[model samples]
Target chain A: MIMQTIDLEADGLRALNATLHAQKDDTNQTSWEVVNAKGSHAIAVGLDAPIEVTVRGSTGYYCGGMNKQATINVQGSAGPGVGENMMSGTIVVEGDASQYAGATGHGGLLVVKGNASSRCGISMKGIDIVVHGNIGHMSAFMAQSGNLVVCGDAGDALGDSLYEARIFVRGEVKSLGADCIEKEMRPEHLEILRDLLERAGADAKPEEFRRYGSARQLYNFDVDNAGAY
Target chain B: MCGIVGLFLKDKSLEPKLGEMLTEMLVTMTDRGPDSAGIAVYGADAAGQGKLTVQSDDAERDFASLAEDLGTAIDAKVSLYQKDTHAVLVAPADKLDQMRQALRELRGNVRVMSAGDTIEIYKEVGLPKDVAARFEISKMGGSHGIGHTRMATESAVTTMGAHPFSTGPDQCLVHNGSLSNHNSLRRKLRREGIRIETENDTEVGAAYLTWKMQHGSTLGQALESSLEDLDGFFTFVVGTKDGFGVVRDPIACKPAVMAETDQYVAFGTEYRALANLPGIETARVWEPEPATVYFWNH
Candidate 1:
């Protein structure tokens, strides 16, 4: 139950993250509380723990990489690759996040209060992402499997080149991915989105939201449509 | 999260098979909905008149038990269309009258529409093709039709909450978006026993229009009313026996592309999705006007 609170000034938070990474071997479930984290990069990398890391300000790229059983929390917006290649555990952001917040993550959850930039959850394998704000283009690009929940708007080319993943967007979207199509809007989605929004502390009503997903058009390949998305 | 496709090919003579075409299309969009898969096909041989096609959960349950259960509440054939989570009942062409009685029977909102001889719907934990294949639904040769895909969230992955819901009679709909005022509407729709099968904003949306149809309003009139009454972001494609309607929410955050060619018309979440559908030339592509509902009939 030991807690470590680090406040980064104009200097980089790399040293602190390195310190946290070094502490990953410890048995204790340490809580890292970071303050004044302005656009810091690689804040928490190569950490495997039953511990928790919290970033209180804006963060830069690859905030949480190669994660294994560790939990990271960002109080504000995060730059790209917030939880890239995370094997397990959870990462929560209280505000909007930048691009690639959870790129190539294989497991766990990434919760964001605001919108995300391009490739927000690109190439995700088994991660569960819940975003309260809008998401930029190419989210879940080439994703293999996972769940992505967006409570706000979505930019163009959402879920492009996706595979076996489940995505729920409560707001508007500029476009859908290639090989994506419209399906029926059924009741199951309302209840699911309702629960997700409630869990994320979003204000949008589950019933008011319509469901947008894959059209199941490209499960197998065809020669005539090889060039198509 | 999933995608779905259903076709009731009324014309048996159409070459290349409508069922195969729809299934292929469904399979092509697996990336849009890929949790699970199913599809339903009703050939011309199974065709019947004055029917309401429902593609919902409990496909195994016999239509007799379902119809008998609601025998006293509503006046419609609850049998015939049963595929997993979907059920298509053939009701009176006057969508409003049947809807009023339906409201008094079910506990939850049923995504309902009235249009023609065929009502197509598919939904589930997987992609659109999976849902369509579940019920052997291969083709829909009616004058018009409806379809949908799903990405799960607050609800469970089940057949009941799938798309292309029929509001009795010959009407059906496919939706993309959410309703900000769904709870308020659900209360009103359920007050009369219109038992909602699932807990989706789409059910509420369908119910809103079903209520209007039940109260002696034409499909177009009902959609016009909904333009003012409903809240949230959405784009909808509705179909009937003779024609269809398309509408967008007042604040269209969802993407719905509109395409028209000399032979056919289509819409999808992304232009790329419809890259090869019918007259898919770049010049015919267009985005739907936000917050406006337009209907087409032959």
Candidate 2:
């Protein structure tokens, strides 16, 4: 199928996103290129079909938010809430992303080639996030189910109040949050890490990473762990 | 949410573009804060001269003959330059306090924004674009500056409630989050005799830094102490006569990005605010660490 190209500078955010929404359920119109984005907000939100979107420049808040089967690519840096609450499909950011990237996402594969700011993947459920560079504090906070792969460092209070989500980091961890701790990397975990790295197109080997998860100490209310509350 | 942008030029060649670049960065954050806006520019200083940036709801009544009135009251030369709702009063360096006191006695509605040899603050209750255009910010030149767009989570939405609050001479601060202990801290700082004009929580934060620096702490030390003293989720960007600093709370709930090159050091609430800056494509960009003070001095 022939791909459609939308210039954000000429068409504006309303027209460009309206066109994508109109073609959401049409499988034939599968490919799109968005040029001159220039930090516009809320691009390609609530897409429900398996389409391909490429954004040429940096975007503002909530870019590619609440997606369900479309693949979105941002060639430059992104503002806050990139791929927020995404249910399924893929979002790739070739440059750095601001705070709360992939926040509260349910299901999808989000790839960040550069650093992600504070609170990356907070409260994520079932989504798989792969970041090639460093991630900031409070990442994966209260996450229920998902996989977060970081090729570089993780900042203060990583995986705070985590629940069921798996975290893998290749570099130094500044600090860990309550009920979250380092666990031994088994063979199966290594295989999963390798798969995630390959899928995210990262160069680092899976063996260099360490695993972190909930310690299960704070799973239930107890007098012994009352101080943790 | 609030937004902050700071730029410190290390190379003299970029001085001419300081206001233009800062204005663009400030406008990009209009979504983060749409209620009010402000900017603080550190221009070249004249020897033995200081400037007082003052705002009045009735500029016509208060600023019509303010220079002459203040000049007579303080027994010195005072030149007033009006820009819409604000005005800059240049006076003898030694007579700044006297001039401030006289202005207070003369005009009850006048509020001093900043008084320094190099700093001139212009802020109002409007969008960033409108505020910048009102003050002709894009045409001004300086070595460094800081700008803020306020969402007004705390206090009333008045002209004095806007950000880039300057409580000390040549000192100003912009904040992105709320300060939980501002009421108690405001009283404490007031006891210490730091001049605070607004009920805005950000003003208390700025006054705290000014008090600390007055008590012999450096800008970096003052910011470091803020992590322990101030209670709340906050990201602070501060400007002094010759320095710029940034700090985030331990929780780091607010977003902040910094970029640096040999020519300059720039800060923004998001990377998009810094994307259009010169040498940004190759600049070293990263998120400031939690509870750590990052500062640069010329």
Candidate 3:
């Protein structure tokens, strides 16, 4: 594996993304390192190749957005919208994530080793997110389809107006949003949790977590359920 | 989308560099808000004197002998330090209210930017770089400060519309998000005798805190109540005589990143503003939670 180090400060964000986008499956530069990220926006966005990119420092908005077939690793914290609309990729944050992490992602695995801010996995679709620490309010809000696993506490109104998303939380939830309630964890969920925990490097037992999902009553417009709307 | 940057120095060694540090932080967020810029610096307080930072559209005519003229009117000794379109008048602390009254009568066009023992505010309608350069804010020294770059959503792009609205002595606030109920709140605060200047939403927020503090509430308590009373999205960074505070609305969609070292506590709308701070690599960086108040005092 070849490693290429690009100074984000000197090379600029456009050049860095262009270089990363130039890589093909057979490209020798399989691993790329971005230094001096310095909280700039839109780093490593819209990549189609199956290459691994590592960001050394913190980032600004929309890092690794619209990712496809790329494994991006942020050694530091990420700003809003990390791994947004990702399709078949893995993005790992060694530090915390700002709001809306993995929002509207289609298919991917996003691992946040530290705490995640509000709206984590919001409007998510088919993405699997594993958070090792606490998550802020309104996580998985209006989530269409996904698996959100939290190893620690969740903030207020978790999973409001959810849709077919499986949420497994090992710690306390401050409050649940409308149409969301606790569900019984079965054998398949435990197996999925175990596999995700192993892959995300989390140190928690699968059985310790509880499952949550939509009650599905508000799917259709009913006058009796008007208050929940 | 406005941008706010605040620095509260815990270490005295960083005092002289406060303006330089805040200037860099503020200018980095110029793209966030480019209509106007402002800064509030809390410098060293004199033993028995207060400084009033005043701005005038016609600085050359209005600020010429206004200090000497106001001193005679208020029966006190006053000294003036002029910076571009603004001037800082140092007078007796007790005579500040008299000075305020006298200045209003003396020059109808001059506006008091701020009045307090140590706090001096300078804001203007321009880009952050030009505004900071006009006031030479980078050359000023202080213990703590807050700066803002405005995008001008709520009100017109004018000098008064720029942020760092100081409704109380030694108190200033800069906001990132818009307030929905500021017009009504402005009327209420005006009825309660709080001097709110502009139609800008942030001025109402500043006046709201000033009113709360005047009603025997601490700055922390005032901010806590603001979460309940103030309607709309806001990420407010406030500065007092000896304190700095940060608070966001319940549905905090606006961005706020904070970094704390043993030396200082810093706030920025984005991490890029704080990226150049000293010891930031090892600083405890995090986002201020929604509906949470984080405050530090000297």
Candidate 4:
């Protein structure tokens, strides 16, 4: 696989991303190096082919938004919506990430080696997010499906209006949101957590973390749940 | 959405580079807001003297010979320095109120942005880089400063509506979210004798903090009180005579990042705003928790 180097400082964000989007599936280019990111927004979006892209510096909003099959790596921090609505592939951030790191993602692996700010995984569908550091408030809000693993503390309202998503936290949870409750970490859950931890290169043991999910009481409409609404 | 950037130098050796570093941080957030921009700088203050930063739409006509006229009217020594649409008038500290009153009666078109011993504010309706260049923000030196770029969701785009609203003598605030109850709050604050100039919701937030602090609450306490009093999503970066403080609403909706190093403490709506700081690579960066007030003082 030949690697292509795209310098954002020289080529600009739109041109570089446009070139990546234009590549054919059978094209010889399979890897890309993005130099001097310097906090540019929408660096890579809507790629369907299996390619590897490495960003050399910090990025602004929506670094890998709606990614399909590209493995994106940020050597430094990222702004909001790191992998928003991603369908498949992997995104790894070596430094901290801002709000809504993996918002509404469907099927992908998003890993943040440092802290993720507020609403880290809001409305997640089927994505797998692993944060090695703390996460801010209202993370995983109204999540429909997916897995979020936080190795550090989570701020207020961890999972408001949660649905079928599974949350694993290794540190303290300030508060849980409505309909989200702490549940037992069963043997099969530990096995999945261990795999996620290993895949994300997190050092924490799976057994040390706790699990949280929807209470299922709000899943069906009932007169008794009207007060919660 | 709006963008805010603040820098408070812990090391005086980095003072000379404050404006340049802050300008870079502010310009990086141009995409977040494009309507208007403003900045407040805390420079060296002479004892017994205070500064009044004012802006006029017609700077040429309003600022010409204004210092001479103000000195005669208020019976105090006044020195004026003009930069683009803004001017800083230095006068005796004891005569500060009299000078403000005289200016208001003499020039109805000039609005006082701030009056304090150390602070000066410059703002205009334009892009952040253009506004910064118009005021020559990079050429000035200060110990600390704050900047804001507005997208104008809740108010009109006017010069007086720009951010870094200075409702207190030595204090200002730049906010990134809207206040749901600003109309009622504005009326209430005005009923209490708090002067608010613009229809901008952010100005009401600044005025609320000033009113709280004037009633003897410390800056941190006033910020703490705002978490309960101010309604709606907000991330506020406030500047005082010798301090810089940050606070987010209980829900923590609007984004805010803080970085602290041996040389300086910086605040931004996002981390990219802090990327160009002097020692940011080694700085301790974190998101300010919801309803928490973080402040640093000289």
Q: After superposition, how far is residue B204 of candidate 3 from its true place, in Å?
A: 1.3
Off by over 4 Å in 1: A1-229, B1-17, B36-48, B54-116, B120-124, B192-194
Tens digits of per-residue lDDT, candidate 4, B118-226, equal 9999999999999999999998888999999999988899998998998588989999999999999999999999988878899899889889988999878988999
Candidate 4, TM-score vs. the true structure?
0.96
RMSD of each: 20.6, 2.2, 1.0, 1.8
Q: Candidate 4 residues A26-116, lDDT tens each?
A: 8678899999787778988888778899999888889999998889999988988999999999999999999999999998899999999
- Go through the candidates in order and give each one's C-alpha lDDT: 0.63, 0.91, 0.94, 0.91
Candidate 3 similarity to native, TM-score: 0.99
> Which candidate has the top score in DockQ?
3
* Pairs that collide, model 4: none
True contacts kept of each: 0.00, 0.32, 0.79, 0.32
Candidate 2 has which clashing residue pairs, if any?
A: A126-A145
Identify the candidate with maximal lDDT.
3
Provide per-model DockQ scores: 0.02, 0.45, 0.89, 0.52
Return the top candidate by TM-score: 3
Q: After superposition, how far is residue B170 of candidate 3 from its true place, in Å?
A: 0.5
| Each candidate structure's count of clashing pairs | 123, 1, 0, 0
State residue B162's C-alpha deviation in candidate 2, in Å: 1.0
